[model samples]
Target: MKRESKLEFRLTYDDSKEIEAIVCIIPGGAEDMNSYIYIDDYLTRNYKVAVININYHCIGNRPHLGSSFYLDDIDKFILDTSLKAINLKCINVYDINSYENLNNTFIKIDQEIQKLKLNQQLHQNYKLKTHVSFLPFKNEYQN
Candidate 1:
């Protein structure tokens, strides 16, 4: 059975300045976005980064055929669409420690955040260079 899916997310950022980067928190197993509040809070409160808590496909075990959560093509589509929303040339950090594990790591989120925070200088001045093969892509593909 196929179910309609939408990119559900919670974007949290401190409006003190232009957002430096975006942190994506993806929960695993039957956990919902709420389960990663600690990570979200730590990112936004401590750093000048915007945190996007993504409720990826099959979260909370709504419905599925397999015994466990499998990364489907649709899941990639949803994740791609979600990240594409931000046009800024900022660093994107994906926290997938709890992506597909039934018994995922919790403390890893904190550790990872700390690591990224410490390495901010490495990417702080980085800029993305875009080369256009043809004209800019049409916006009609957006739903």
Candidate 2:
């Protein structure tokens, strides 16, 4: 962690493997970096990527000061240009569990679809509809 820069983060990586990707976990609006330790652990162990639990700006007072003292904390830090990865998974790093849940539902739906010999196109439609409907409800039920 660099103290001089306003942006602060916790990095988790498996040194045994050659890490080529970075998984930056951004906490929720009122939440801090600790909220996503489970996520960081999962990603690093499963995906073999570097996990960065960023302490970004928060709305109210917080112990870690929400990454730093500045309001625009994230933009202050610069990413290494030499970095390479399959994709940069940034933004909304909070609700990763919701995605996992949705995936489980999708798997079940796919199994049902196969068993019933239903049209693939119709199955896709149902999945899209379910995902869109589920999006608005994810935050409502969260603590």
Error of 1 at 123 (Å): 67
C-alpha root-mean-square deviation, candidate 1: 21.5
Clashes of each: 0, 0
Instruction: List model 2 lDDT by residue over 1-143, tens digit each.
Output: 22333555899988887898988788876677877888888888888699989865422244343222221222112111111121222322223244455355446545654543454423344431221222211112211
lDDT of 1 by residue, 77-127 (tens): 444344344322232223332234312422333344355446773244433
Please provide TM-scores, in order, for all candidate models, with all chains considered together.
0.39, 0.37
Evaluate all candidate structures by whole-model CA lDDT and list the values in order. Answer: 0.51, 0.48
Instruction: Tell me the TM-score of model 1.
Output: 0.39
Per-candidate RMSD vs. true structure? 21.5, 19.6
Model 2 CA deviation exceeding 4 Å by range: 1-6, 59-143
Question: Which numbered prediction scores highest in lDDT against the true structure?
Answer: 1
